[model samples]
Target: MKGPLFYSKILLFGEYGIIKDSKGLSIPYSFYNGALKNDGNASEAALNSNQSLKRFASYLKDIDQDLVRFDIDKLTDDVNAGMYFDSSIPQGYGVGSSGALVAAIYDQYAFDKITVLENLTREKLLKLKQIFSAMESFFHGKSSGLDPLNSYLSIPILINSKDNIEATGIPAQQSDGKGAVFLIDSGIIGETAPMVSLFMENMKQEGFRNMLKNQFIKHTDACVDDFLKGDIKSLFKNTKQLSKIVLNHFKPMIPQQFHELWKKGIDTNAYYLKLCGSGGGGYILGFTEDFEKAKKALSAHKLEVVYNF
Candidate 1:
């Protein structure tokens, strides 16, 4: 059976901020998508996915009955029916690969789950977040459930604060603008669990907390505001600072080899690069007003344009 597709997600802003009740924004990325399909090629990927879903079903069953609920029988039936996730989104790159999968499963198998047609009010949204949190914990060890929620809903999700989220709109991508926003694949996979654990450990240090509050989150919050206000110039300026801050303070999250390339953008003023997801090795988002100059500066790497004006 063919099921609705779910796309990957990009957390445009509020990576670590939303956890602290900072304003956040996330948008669906359609370039990479996945859907549930009945297929005979139960190869390694399919088998692995099947095992994962099975484990997730068990986790759901094991959860506190009052806190989360789902129809396990139906999910089991679908799994037995050769349901496999056929997807292009890369796994472990921090770009919602597993998030899309989790969303698709929830959309299809939850008997009493909220439907897309139903009014997804704030109450329902919060409930879904709770359910999805328990459901997705099978994959992430710990989860905020925001990624799958964003993918399942396939809309721009704005986090006004930690307890609040709603669908929102972004300024339409400019058609005639000279600047471009794009993705630069790091050509390596990144595991979320370890990266998150590292972040948690770093949180214990007073110095790290200070950097996050005074510098990293400050510039990040500015980038989000400037972007939403359509202040392209300021957005890029803050993004450069954010990129540099990440490069210096978040060195562990960045792959070692790309350090020079990361600094080159700041030193040359051609482009500013930042993490797309948690940033161990996934796709890095790049901002460049002059595409040609950014391209020339980083000609050695592959670049994919998400939007151009």
Candidate 2:
């Protein structure tokens, strides 16, 4: 038995800012994806996924019926029958690995689930976000559910704020364009819970809270707006500001080795680096007006371009 595939997601503009009700832009990353399959063999990876699914099934059964209803019995039976998630999405990469898993489960097991084919009204989008948040919280202590939502709908999601979101169309990618948005591998896995916890701790400081509201969120919102409107100049400008703010404030979230590299982008104007997700060590996002220049500057590291403009 196999279910349809769900793609990974990239929260392009908002990472930590969204937690504070900042505007966010997320797009599907089709380069990595996952699906559920029953191989009837207990390979180590499959068994591990099956065990995780078992725990997830139990958690789903405990959710309030008014919130979401799932076929818990069927989920359990499938796990027992060696059903596991067959995925290539890397965990701890901030690319929505667990989110794809959640989306797949919700798609397969949720009773009366909102099909992606339906006309997704604002109300339906919010409901899906709420349900996904509740379901994904089992993995992360708290969640916005944006990752799973992006993966499930396979479209760009624009979050005006926590309560307001919609499907959005981004600027068309230009194949011949020199500007690009890319990902740099940190080669270290990051756990979401700890990074999130650290962010929460930092939120307690009045100075940090002020910085988040005044600087971080403001730039993020602008970046989102500029990207959607196809304002390349303003998008790059705001992205540079946002990158600087992240470097100054989100230090711990940035892996130590990349600190100079992050700053060099700002200094050289070759590219701007920012957190991809809950960054401790995962993929750091890079934006450059000239892809060739940025590639030349960071020749030592592995870079994967996500979009071109």
Best by TM-score: 2
- lDDT string for model 1 (209-288, tens) is 99888888788888878877888889888888998888988888888888999998999989988887788898888889
- lDDT per residue, candidate 2, 1-309, as tens digits? 889999999999889888889999999999999999997866899899989988989999899899899999898998888899989999999999999999999999999999999999999999999999999999998999999999899999999889999998898999999999999999999899999999999999999999999999999999998998989999989999998999999999999999999999999999999999999988999999999999999999989999999
Stretches off by above 4 angstroms in model 1 are none
* Native-referenced Cα lDDT, model 1: 0.84
Name model 2 segments beyond 4 Å from true. Answer: none
Winner by lDDT: 2
Residue pairs that clash (backbone atoms under 3 angstroms), model 1: 177-309
TM-scores for the candidates: 0.95, 0.99
Local distance difference test scores for all models:
0.84, 0.94
